[model samples]
Target: MRHFLYICLFISITINSQESIDATLIDSSNLNADQIIDIDNFETLYFIKDHTIYKNHSNKKSINYSNYQLGEITTANVFNPLKINLFYKDFNTVVILDNRLAEIFKIDFNTIQPYKNITQVSTGFDNTLWIFNIDFQQLELYDYKTNTTRFSAVPVQSDVLDLESDYNYCWLLTKNYLYQYNYFGSMISKIENTGFTEISKSNGHLILKKDNILYFKHKKKEEIQPVNLPKLLINQFLLTNETLYIYDLEKLHKYQLKIK
Candidate 1:
């Protein structure tokens, strides 16, 4: 009887451990773009086509921004819709765009004092930018208004694969680990990388992708749970607070994350 009870308990634990979160297909639409950059809270679509950034709104006419001289746009950050950040790595420049895709300001790292080779840039609070200074191998919160760095994190030895931030926290995904830092430049959490290629943040939770599979890491949980999604060819993906958007070259599918 003792052995039989132990066998039943083991089976119950295995069954519970194998259960995964479900993602229901809420909506889908045809998407034709070279890449899907982001979908804002207002349902505005931002994408890239032929080296140009395009913004498509439901109620407004589409507008695009392009600079052939900049070579190529390395990244487009729509964290602040009013102040979109376009990073041109080849020229070491950042172009700030308004809501209508109009260039409002430009920052050329080449012309800045104490030269910074910025490989990545994201929106920071109150007219600031979170930039990765390759020269120092550090992540610096730069005050573009004052032309100075407010604070910087410790040097990261590995190559940074992705950088995403909100108003209060910054997350960096390196080749070996994923790190989260607070606004005061203090390390919050560090999780060893397990082949994660991309990351997106929403409401303090982390959504990570390894190849084509998606994983979710809650701010309060240490375990990274796999998001059970229907089989689809994932070319690009975006994670919002409640929805997971996946693009498969021809169509964009929206899945509602049903976390229990």
Candidate 2:
């Protein structure tokens, strides 16, 4: 009788776990490590391999660009499909690329006035950039056109773990909390960190990872919803335009989200 009860309990837990998953596999491929950095809804893929940037379009053609002078690219932003931003943290510079991966403009922060120790950057509205000045522990709205600081927010109390932005809003994640700021550099909202290890945002929706579990939250929802992934081990992942891409053991898995 005891053995039968233990088996039943295990079965019940397995069924409940299977029911929580709300996703379908779309496609997958084997990708090299740290190669893919960003992917847009239009199927445009941005990757960094061998100290060079590669932009691949849906039509299967690709353009490669590199700058040995910048040393190495710390991060790349493909939020605006038309304008791509690359941050060279070592040199404190940003290179803006057009849709075809052509260099439109490059700004070196060391030469600018006020002397910003920029650690991260993202695309902002109307030819502006969302930048975090490590020296001030503040977020700044910088205009690439005139090479000026348009707006600067107050210093954050904690060290920023990651930063993201869209056209209208910017999201900053620290060790203890997450902060939201508008284009005008005003604090809009904040949420407790709650042990989130990774975060990705697109089209007003956010996907957070804590341990092996995933959470989904949108601007419209007050509470985050938990998600059960089919796979347990995730090396890296990204969420954008209703699609979830998970990379594990050199293989990329794409899943279409079916939110409840």
Candidate 3:
């Protein structure tokens, strides 16, 4: 009887653990989106299709911009809906575009005095930019207007895997650690890397992915929760307070989060 009861308990525990990750697919759409960007207080979805950048509003209207001369876009920032920054690593250039996807200004890092190789770039407060100079292995705040380095941190110890920033803070992820810095290039905080490959941040929440599985860590929560992914072959994903969007192949899946 004791052995039988132990077996029953083990089975119950396993079943409960599996059921804890319950999720429902709300809807899906067919779109060849390589990357997606959602704006605040809007129904528009901006994404990359082929070598061109597209802005889709309510799935009713679409806008696009492409430049073959710029080569492939390394990354894009829609931090400020009014101004967009697109980076091309191979050319060492950054192009600033208006809301309509029209080019406003372009910066070629190769021409900058005291030459530096910029591996990552992000928007900063007051018309500034947060950039990681690969040659110096340092984080720099650059004022585009004056073409000056406002501030810079000492060389980081590890190779930065990813860089993210908002108006006030910049987050740097290395192989072994994640460091946060202020606009003045002061180290605000650092956390040990938990072996996650991709990261997304929005409104103070952090989401990470590894092996196609996502982990969500809320700002106040002490633990990270594993997102119940629909499948294990996700191409890319985005998370908001209420929804999780996953892209696999040419389909986009939306899952409504039931977080407490």
Model 3: residue 138 alpha-carbon error in angstroms: 1.3
Clashes of each: 0, 0, 0
Global lDDT of each candidate: 0.89, 0.83, 0.78
Off by over 4 Å in 1: 1-17
Candidate 3 overall Cα lDDT vs. reference?
A: 0.78
Error of 1 at 66 (Å): 1.2
Kindly list the per-residue Cα lDDT of model 3 for residues 173-212, writing each as its tens digit. Answer: 8877777787778897778877877777776666777677
Best by TM-score: 1
TM-score of 2: 0.88
Evaluate residue 2 in candidate 1 and report its C-alpha lDDT on the 0 to 100 scale. 100
Predicted structure 2: lDDT: 0.83
Ranking by TM-score: 1, 2, 3
* Every model's TM-score: 0.92, 0.88, 0.85
State the displacement of the C-alpha of residue 103, model 3, in Å, after optimal TM-score superposition.
Answer: 1.1
Question: Which regions in candidate 3 have their CA more than 4 angstroms from the true location?
Answer: 1-24
